[model samples]
Target: MALDKKTIRLLILEDSQNEAERLVSLFRNAGRATRVHRVTSAEDLEASLGQIWDLLITAPSSAALDPTQAVSAIRRHAKDIPVIRLIEGNDSDAITEALALGAQDAVPQGEDERLVLIADRELANLEERRARRAAEVALREAEKRCQLLLDSSVDAIAYVHDGMHIYANRTYLELFGYDDVEELEGMPMIDLIASCDQVNFKEFLKNYQHQEGSAELVCGGVRADGGNFKARMHFSPAAYDGEPCIQVVIRTESDSAGLEEKLREISSQDLVTGLYNRNRFLEMLEPAVERAVNAGQEASLAYIRIDRFAGLQAELGLADADLLLSDLAQLLRARFGAQQPLARFADDVFTALLPGSPTAGAEGELRALLKQAEAHLFDIGGRTVQLTLSIGLAGLDEKTARAQDVIDRAHRCADEAGDGNALKRYDPADELAAAANRGSVVAMVRQALERNGFRLLFQPIISLRGDTYEHYEVLLRLLNPQGEEVPPTEFLAAAKEAGLAAKIDRWVLLNSIKLLAEHRTKGHNTRLFIHLSSASVQDPGLLPWLSVALKAARLPSDSLVLQLSEPDAIAYLKQAKVLAQGLEELHCKLAISQFGCALNPFSTLKHLNAGFVKVDGSYTQDLGRPENQEALKTLLASLHSQAILTIVPFVESASVLATLWQAGVNYIQGHYLQGPSQSMDYDFSPDE
Candidate 1:
């Protein structure tokens, strides 16, 4: 073994100058440049051992200069350095005794390679120790800085580990009626919350353990005097003293200052429920909408209504009904806390702004909460009443530019789902078509199909990693008799209802392939993404038809990708599996769009062989919010882990590009890149 040009510090115990010179020559030949210090007597060896050295080489000598005695003396000064014993011959007994005395290794004389290898190994180990020691020192300094910040901070902050307080800032000590942090340390976190909220706080922690980002909740805080005050607490995961902990920030109702500011806050608050009034909610929503547009992330508005609320108000007096609403508001606040903004949109109707489109867990929790509320009987001045809730959720997207429009859509959806008291998502196409005459819409779709009035538009999907192939999603638009383009949502439902989806899919496929071939001839390598309706998933002849179409156009089968929505794929799982396999056989790829919406999305993935997954639009549209960003990062990680290329759709803003790149998404498509166009043209230059 030859060492690289690293200079070794060698301390040798030898009586002969010739032997020392020979050892140094061996090391130099092995590429180890060394500074050799030859010491013979015990006093010289002890004095030389004071300096730092990499290795100690002891050549076998007479009784006056014993290698074992030198090894013992070196250990007394610095036990960490490796000691190599040089034996003149094969003396196994002496090697064993030398090792027992602290020799790191034994090498035969003239074996320069063995000595060099031992020295290199000892040097590497020492470097590792130094690095670990430096890291420990840095951690200690970080902890001290954290402590200093805590001591100087005016805001009440505390840290808890294993549900017990481990540390508290000065402001926290003052607010909790304690003199020192030591007094607050080791106290149970529940003890700080009032008796009524203790149970809820415990439950919150259980759910929060799985939550990715920081969360806030309003609870009753108790002071040393046993007085309770409403307080908002924020919990963020943190590390302290090299152990995991939760940092808590507490703000009380009395923390606000100045009468004028307080009055202004009250002006925006609903007196009956203490939630944000309609005007305030609308004001807040304007910025939220702007943020969503600029951040290219999804934010959602929820409209909730009480079923038969008018009858309940009639049965109970107006005052009593108002009391019931107030009680309901309190319940909402208790359950959701400050996770998102809540407002009283109208009489008996509430609206909530979810910054990040609610997760599947959030959706389920709300559904369960609604069920619990429905089953609970309310007592209003001796009168008993039961109410069900209808909730409608509408996510902010490129089309939903106006806050008022989103709120209106959500309200309309909730009213439409009133009979079933269901939770419905706002579907733009469905909302628009509901206002049109159904017979006229059906006739219009049929006429447009017959006239071949449908036009294909392509939207480029940009690749973050600079892939050479060009990709675009083929969108369809139906031109009416007046030459007006009908929104896909409006015409798609009518077509599906009239059993025209299969024909429509065929239309889209044929046009996309024709366009792809023409674009390829112009020297553009392009692939088009086309949607497959549920009807097409069951069309056994679709694959054969595609084979003929590809052969006719002389287009590569892989140029066209078939996309199936998660809901449609799940609704026709067996057929979807067959279609996926068939598409594979045809050398085409299958992509599952609107994925991660199912109760068990990965379960559906297990049944199908999909090459790509487009994460649901709701999750990607709100990348501006910190919580949403974290959620998207986690989802992208899962998709990448499974070796499935992820394509995040609805990339409507430039701000989201960096985040998407960081997440390692394969492709991105949205209005910001370019709306669907008649020509398959998008600037693919790296400069852009």
Candidate 2:
């Protein structure tokens, strides 16, 4: 079984034993393992609460203990159990009351399917909460360990916030001639600098603040005892207690060991290229790979091999070939600079490690370098020779555990390119690899669709304009044999090629309608934003089937907001227009997501009566720039003028909220507020 699909520990607060067994069977039939504990009285409920329970199911009105008493007991115990109250019929009042009294949800009696869906949602949410708690505890422990290391260090280290001393280690305090930490705290760093070099130091600090890397300054220091000394200070960005600050380390010039430092540098450098050699490169790569795996840092590696190097070496003498290699090394150094780690790995192969580079950015840089190398003419002994490069790129992520594995993957990718000035990126699921098992994957997808092995995740779309209705964007995922959820981006293309996209879309629509209907019966006005694939948009029967599904579920047509991608709507404008008109006739709303991506986005909008337009996330991500902000504001103003509600996704932080609010964005959705989950549990009332 997958790590995510653990057995749920269920607590049932029902009077009848048979009903409890039936509920267990329902969950088991739906592919969920359950460890159930039935509670008939208050004592049983209290005892069960003592143990860890993932979900709680109770009767709305029972002879032994009602839901009210059960919920009260749960609160009294200070447990994080989700309660689902079962009502006798579609009793909206009872359901609403149960929810108001702190139940996660309420299900109608005999609706086994509805109950199981709600249970799955609750269990998933419970698991996420538990995982978050565990992560928090681990973070706290790690912080403690780091603090211990900092306190025990011998270096004179201090953390400064806004130029004032916030924290200083014992060594730092002693070096500053201060007896207690209180004396050193809240002191301006400028006060410790000698007056003669203070201006230059201030200028250095100002310049360092705008840069990406660290810098060191040699200046005169003034101690608390009115003594002076020559000191070297290294400044780097750091954070203390979750607030950004600058870390400062001061060492006296007299403590420097010049010979030792020179020897270390000589040992780490390559004689020919004057760059880091293989051993030093591996040493640097180890920590980078560790950071990428443990701290979610982004990094990439590029393996470049000179195409037809052996032929050139054979033509040129050995000395001239060495000269050519040296010339090429200079070019590499000038192109990559000191920011990235570059090394000459073998006779004709070079490696560059790009720290803090995403895969796309790394690819762009490598392609540009490849183009430059192809155009450059290397002069060796008055002989000009031009050569091409075959480069392979691989990203360092959590899946990359060993440094050697990353290099090996990149090397394999380069070899596969076959040395024609080709560039390839290492992908675990490459086309050739996937083609070998395409039949198996297609079978898995078909089986999932038939057996209801797909799961729907809901991400809340919050209203920045005070809309009170609960809104969620529906997302689909497939479960493999191991029960791990696979994102649609990984399998949807194959499904489309297999002619299953339309059928999959129908399954999502039917399930969404069924779930929404059950939820609405609990006296909540909920709306879902469902996405339509290109195949679904072009399918002539989709609109009719959707209408029938809505009517059968007895749901209001307006409650379903059908969404179409901008590209798909542009490609199939006529079909999309017809579908939009048909949905409008059914009293449903239309939304165009990833809008404003085309050369003329408004042209597509003019053809369809879309009520909502979700601007492409790139616009939101680029809001930090003034020009991008102006562009987004202009687009939002135009949409508002046309009476179209605007949604901006990928709002990652609170820093952009005021700007978005000023721009008149109707809704903002991102992980900063809440990521996609199995429940629509966002607290929209507070914003309203």
Candidate 3:
């Protein structure tokens, strides 16, 4: 009797096609949908091995090929595929020799049931190997991404294990007067603190680990040159290199004239405009520049000059001009907000500092704001007065090492922009040329959302254990103005920063459910896996909206499995818990994808009702290695103990399938089965 039914490809090496057909008939009778290709000569056998096949069977005493030579060829070219040798007359010595020559198992002629059973076992082994290699690739990619984020952090951050520094960002090295990470290697955490606070700091560390949350301390910091400065350090329990560590963030307090000037301006406020005075804006600019430089971020400075301020004042009089200026200031505040520093620099000039990486969208938005101001007619003292603005935008980059340099550059650009053009951007490298590139990518994203310019792609999630339900993961793609397809990785971050991620998520959710409804009408029990963003986790409206959409589509909740990345779930734990609980109430399943990379991934699951956990693909990319195999087995064992179904993704080759089966993975997915397609056309029926 057949133990399982699966579609498997087979390669046979035999002189007689009849004999190869008989061997293939055994697998077919055992309930496997077998795709068999017979190769009699050595050349044909080599060609057959080059293609995809699940198992290889060789016939001994053939006229065209030697069984030993065939095994040798398979071992050299396609070693991952299991090879079986068929001997005649129950020759024990021949079976022993074949087994020693790397054949997985040797069986006598006939006895079709035993042959089928051996093939089934070998196929399972092949599946496990393929799963493990996929995992290793995912892990390396995750590590690379983590390193990039750590390097780009704005604060001086470090990870300390056993009271010694294990890892530090670029900002941390610069703050402690170290040129390279090697200089701080094995350095004690206490050494960074001033001698005066050493005793108190030691006491704090002793009790730090036992505390529930993060702890902050204000202490004097000692630099490598022995200089001391006031510093505030925050300590939290984190993990580094697969071990527990303390994450530290240090911020040094400035004691320069700029700081004192900023303090003086904080007490006095501009009554009319509700903005900072000139000194305050310039003071904040210095710190913004420092952060942008150290963190590899860009700080944008905008210099706005009222076009022909003297003429406006003369025509409208002092009282009217003052009202107009105050009204304009109110408008600017309404538009830019007070997140960064906004200040009235002079009688008619205003300035604002934009912190973070400068995007093309910021420049385009500023210009658009300028255009709006030009188009608006102000009602001042019962009379209509029109005003225009000459705006200059300067972004912090390698050339502008000093904060004051960028400020001067913006002023020069504004001065050069005259009244005709009225807008200019300081781009020494011509990198932000408006004519060369379209307006902001964020603007493009908004337009796409408004026009419904998004498309969906589906990738099959095959069942390793012969589950009947058809599964596919839904992926999103955006079409740009040029009709070019923009991948999610390229535009998804921009959408999130622009606060449009929730809208995108809803679009995918509704569309996927609608498609699922249509797919079910075809008599196929199909399920779609959809991804959610961090913004979706916090959106209170999403769950209710999803309930309505599902009801309208007449689709069951279980047909859709909403998933979020593991890092995102950890970042927004409270919101994730709510989403998970709400999904449970809705009778929907939650999948935490890209899992097992956190400090303690299981800790995350303890708070949520995630029924499926997709193991991070990095663990399986190199499953042939013994270490990865052991790690995957351990994770699977832990997950299975909790009765949670494990999904091993990125299964690219047959080599890792056997290892995955051994590790007890319930499901598998990757490009090896199929890349994403417009239709869910994967052959789910094993009988096919």
Candidate 4:
């Protein structure tokens, strides 16, 4: 089952509402949507424990409730909630005490970054525990169902371990002329065989255990009533109660025909919607992938997910949700046709394979299906509910190596398109961009660092409100052997993987500072936004190194605005926060580029003292859409209300100038304004 990635349910033990809000802001800023419940009393903590919570954060100095009491309450209720204690200052004694009393970890009260990091780790561990619990429950239920099926089978079947009978169905007991399975439970299989055939049967069983496939033997059998009969027994490797065993199926001449076919169909089918199950779909996919790779045949696979099905399930309940799912399965089967290989891959996801079809054709079919799903309303127990579909299509060709990889790619694309009722086709270019063949790139990065073969370019961030001060974002490129500049997107990832990201970041900072110091000597009040990778953000030695570098260049810290991408900032929130604090101490500024893409962009700003935020370029590129325009306007309004200076990038044309200006944007940067050049020569004067 997929864990909910959108929201985290938190229980905070604190006396002050302000402090509680501060804690919530930490998670929010880290791109986590949180539903927080703050409790200051033991009664409140006990009541809250009745419900599920992801993590429990308690203040050791709370006046109304002690941390010990909160931990006690959780233990009494047998809750699995992880506890994090907020201690005063850097009290090592208090941290040790809290852990001894059942807390997972303890953080200093003012160290909000540490708290956020600890909370993130605990929440991840909680998710894994929950998933394991769900798996255990499902396994138990499956075992029960398998037992029921085995007991109800007509063929005589029994399971044996080390030649002793462990289990036998009713038919097997009746065939042996025993009234109860208990009577024959401990009997050896050789004892059941007639004396004359015992030696032959022993040799056959020994050989069967040493082989990989099934084996059969026709031997004389002795019943409990001293009667004899000849029967054919099939032996296959099996497991019982988590132990290796052998499964024996005995068939007399009078047994029914077509039993094997019926069992095969039952094993491959899903009892819920009557479609093929995930295992069966995989069985079919493997052969299809082989045909595509070996025979040059073309095929396309699509992963379909029901949008907001979790919310739908919560509203309609599990029973009605299953009914709705059945209705959806029927609709999918009809649309894809009976010959297509389709399966309910997960609770709210489906997979389909179209043989001899290209991605474009498959995408068209999926779009039509999406439209149909959007139009049709599903009725479950007289309640009508409308839903939309998010489909991801991936083509199978000689490039496809593994069936599982294709499924994963399509699944990722579906998740990317989940926000809207849309379809996304898997693009191999994205994979190629982040490919693992980074040996050459790593070598290039190291050589450039050693020889100073790196170059920096600057693009002017033109102010919409006509501010006099000049601003430019620093861009990095590597000079290859042929003097061609290679973009960071091509090699930065490789450098990061090679543990050289921090070195590269430091090199850029040192050179950029030197250039900025020289430029300032020309009487221009300019500031540069230099981007940092996640590795640099997490580096403990970076701040000290940066301080020394800034002083060596004799540049004002404020003139250098360090920037981080939204994803990197969110991923390393704790480190980013610490870095931001350190930069503030040095009078440097922090800016989050590619911002406004998270679930809560402003939440992150609340935790960090960010002076500038560059909105994601998609907002500017998609300005042609009215909804996108309004979205950008609203996002800017939120940022502006917080007193944040907004920089809108990718201003390719003048058409968006009026909209951006009306939205109170502070700066705009793109090719239309001024592309990145070797020299920072753009004029920042007002258009008089």
lDDT for each residue of candidate 1 in 294-350, tens digit (9 for 90 to 100): 443457788889888888889887999898999888878876658678999899899
Compose the digit string of candidate 2's lDDT tens values, residues 219-255.
Answer: 8888898999888899999999888889998876443
As a whole number from 0 to 100, the lDDT of residue 362 in candidate 3 is: 67
Worst 10 residues of 3 by lDDT: 428-437
lDDT of prediction 4: 0.83
Which candidate has the top score in lDDT? Answer: 4
Residue-level lDDT tens digits of model 4 in 363-428: 888999999999998888997999998998887764465677889889888987865799999876
Mark the regions of model 3 whose C-alpha exceeds 4 Å error after superposition.
Answer: 1-439
What ranges in model 4 sit over 4 Å off?
1-439
List runs of model 1 lying over 4 Å from the truth.
1-439
The whole-model C-alpha lDDT of candidate 1 against the native structure comes to: 0.78
Residue-level lDDT of model 3, residues 49-73, one tens digit each, is 5355778888777778887787767
Taking every candidate in turn, the Cα RMSD to the unseen true structure, in Å, is 31.9, 29.7, 29.3, 29.2
Score each candidate by Cα lDDT. 0.78, 0.82, 0.79, 0.83
